[model samples]
Every structure is written in structure tokens, then in C-alpha cells.
Target: MQSDKPSFVFTGWHMLAAMLLFFGTIITVNFTMAYLATSTWSGLVVKNTYIASQEFNGKAAGIRAMLSTGIKGTLAVKDDSIRYGLAMPGDKPVLADKVTAHFKRPVGEHQDFVTELEPAGAGVYEASRQVLPGNWIVEIIAVKDGETIMHEANRIAVTGEGK
Candidate 1:
């Protein structure tokens, strides 16, 4: 006669070791990811605000130069907000009274995205302009201490929900 019982393939010691290893790895990875994520988020928020503040004119001017070359650069649309950047060269950045973006609608009407920006530092000025869905032409003008220094233009395409 033979009696049947479930076999214990893994001993308690082995199970405990495996569980410790697995949970340790999981916790380590989670902590590392959280740290990276927090750092990145803070950096982005500060950058955006700096750009919007119009403080870094030199940096911002350089960005304008890059975009005017008809090459796609740092401008992007995020959740109904248009984010663009520029860099100017000098000891300081210029704050502008107004930056006007001139574009033509697909139907041939003209539109403008305009704003005044605050200075962020290192010659970078940042601002945001509301934009509609369609093709766009972009231009920026900078005036600092009552002097105009840079102006350039480019084209872009905008697409998303409600554009």
C-alpha cells in the first residue's frame, strides 16, 4: 500500500531567500525611479517658468535664430499650451514689450500670437501665446532697456484636440 502527499519542492529557507531577493529588487527599482522622476519634473517646471519670465534673453535669442532657419527646433505643443524657447548671446537677455507671431490660416487669413515676457536670466526670455489649430508662422521681437536687438520668423504646423 502507498500513501500520496504533496511534495514540498521549495524549503522554507529557499522561499524566504527568494522572497527577500525579489522584494529587495522591487523596492530598489521603485525608489530609483521615483528620485529620477522628481528631479526631472522640478527641472522642467523651473525651465518653463524661466523661459516664460523673459529673463534669459541671450539664450532666447539664439533659439530664435535657430528656428528662423526653417529647421524644426524646440517649440512644441503640450496639452493646449505652446512651448517655445529662445537663446540670446550677451552678458544679459532682453525683455520685450511685445513678441508677435504672424501666421496665415489655411484659408489665407492672418493670425497672431503675441505676449510680453519676463526675464529669467542668462539672456533667455520666456512667454506663452495662445494658438489655434492650423499652419503657423512664428516670429519674435526683443526689446531690452528700450532697444530692439533681434527678430526672426519661421513656420510650423499645429495639430491636436481643438488645436
Candidate 2:
């Protein structure tokens, strides 16, 4: 005589459930680690890049300092307008609330001229006028918080007359 006994056998559903749980946990953990690593590395890269870029720009600005003063590179002329660049010294960039550019005839009366308000960002302004150009003076005034601050690079001349 033999005793009746049953042996435990895993069904397809049991194997499927176990596989699903194992893979689900693995995928979730992988995603979490990836997210954290990416966020950390991206932040570090941004900070480092900003510092390095400022250093490079400082070096370039030093070389460019001479061009803004002497002949040839000092002037900014256009067909119908003129623009000049204003930069703050050191590593920091210029940020002004208001910038004004005034163009006038150097030798003649200053009545026949144009003045324009410049935007922020780059701090440049241009006022166009239809006048026979021989020699004109340009004045740039930058203001912040209702007070006049930086002003330089004056006495720019417009050379040729228009057709």
C-alpha cells in the first residue's frame, strides 16, 4: 500500500508574476539612478562652463580694449544707422536700464539731430537721420534707476553723404 501525496508545481502564472516583479524593480531602480546622475552632472557642467567662459571672455576683452579707442576701429557706421558696443570692465557684463544715443553735426548746430532710446541686453541704440554727412558727433548716455552712470566713447564722426 502507498500513501497519497502531492508535490508543489509552479504554474505559468506563477513564473510570469515572479519575472514581472523582478524586472519591474530592476527597471525602476535603474531609472532612478540615471535621473540622479544626469541631474548632478548637468548642474556641475553648467557651473564649470560659466566660469571658464568668463575667463576666456576676460582675456578677449583685454585684447579688444585697444580697438575701441584709437582710429579705424573706434567708429561704428552704417548705411542708415550707426551702432557702438558698450561693455563693463572686468568679468561682469553690462546691464543698464536705459541707453541713449545722440547723433549731431560736429561743426554745425546741434538742433538737427536724432536721439533714440536703447534696449537692455547689449546696450546699443541708433537714431537715423537724412542729412548730408561730413563730420558728426555721437554721444552715448547710459542710465540706471533714474541716475546717469556710464558715459564715454564720444565724438564719433559720420563720413560720407547719402545719395
Candidate 3:
């Protein structure tokens, strides 16, 4: 004898609903990710790719020449003070007339600023500035006699403590 209760059956409508739900969820997620990716970052590293490519070899040679000078640089950020130091192999100070530090955010240029560090001592330069808490890309250039003697780039993370 059969029971009075009706049994469940899988029909075309159920299949259609399931397929729609699966595809709809995937499409929704894809659209969301695409929007976020495009809206958040511009993904531009240089203003002109062709010009940058043309100058790449010269920049590489300049970097090699700078490295051969055996000058080492150190950067420190603490309590609204940004300090940079340059030294040789035996801790001897490097002779440079001017030093500049270009601070920029990795994703945007709104917070970018260039600070000309004044000489505090032998091969030491410093500036008093409050860096925001986030990721930064810093490019340091040391000029001596109208020529760049040392050029370096570094990535740093600033925390709430400014370290």
C-alpha cells in the first residue's frame, strides 16, 4: 500500500533554476571584481612607455655607474623626522652637495612630495615631515657638481608609530 504523502521529483524547472543560480552567482562575482579592480587602481607606472623604453639602457648604465661608486645609503623615519645617510665602504662619508628624497604612494600620486634634505653632518641629510601611514616608494638622489652621484629607490611601510 502506498502512503498518502506525495513524493518529490526533480523536473526541468528545478534544473533551470539551479543553472540560473549557479551562473548568476558567478557573473555577479565577476562583475564585482572587475569593477573593484578598475576603480581602485589606474595601473599606470609611467606616463610614456615608448620614451621610457628608449631611455632604459641609459638609466641602466647610470645605475651601474652609481653602484660602482660604492656609496651606500640609509633611510630612517622616526617621529616626523626623515633622515638619510650616505657612506662608503669603511663608513667614510660620501661627498655630495645636495640630496633629495621623492616620496610617492605605490598606487597613486596625490600624496607624492619631494623633500630637499639639508645637510646635518658629514654625508647626512634630514627633513622634518610627517609621512602618512601606508606604503610608500621613495627615490633618493644625491647630486654633486651638477651630476647625480647616487640614485636609489626603496619601498617602505609606515605604521602609526612613524617607524
lDDT of each: 0.56, 0.57, 0.92
TM-score of 3: 0.86
Q: Any residue pairs clashing in model 3, and if so which? A: none
- Rank candidates by TM-score, best first: 3, 2, 1
User: lDDT per residue, candidate 2, 39-158, as tens digits?
Assistant: 644333245777788798775664476345331212366676555455545423455577666565544453445565554245454445444556656656666687545554456455
lDDT of 3: 0.92
* lDDT: worst 10-residue window of model 1: 87-96
- Model 3, residue 57: C-alpha shift (Å): 1.3
Cα RMSD (angstroms) for every candidate in the order listed? 15.7, 19.1, 2.1
Judging by TM-score against the true structure, name the best candidate: 3
Candidate 3 C-alpha lDDT tens digits along 94-140: 87899999998988678899999999998899999999889999999
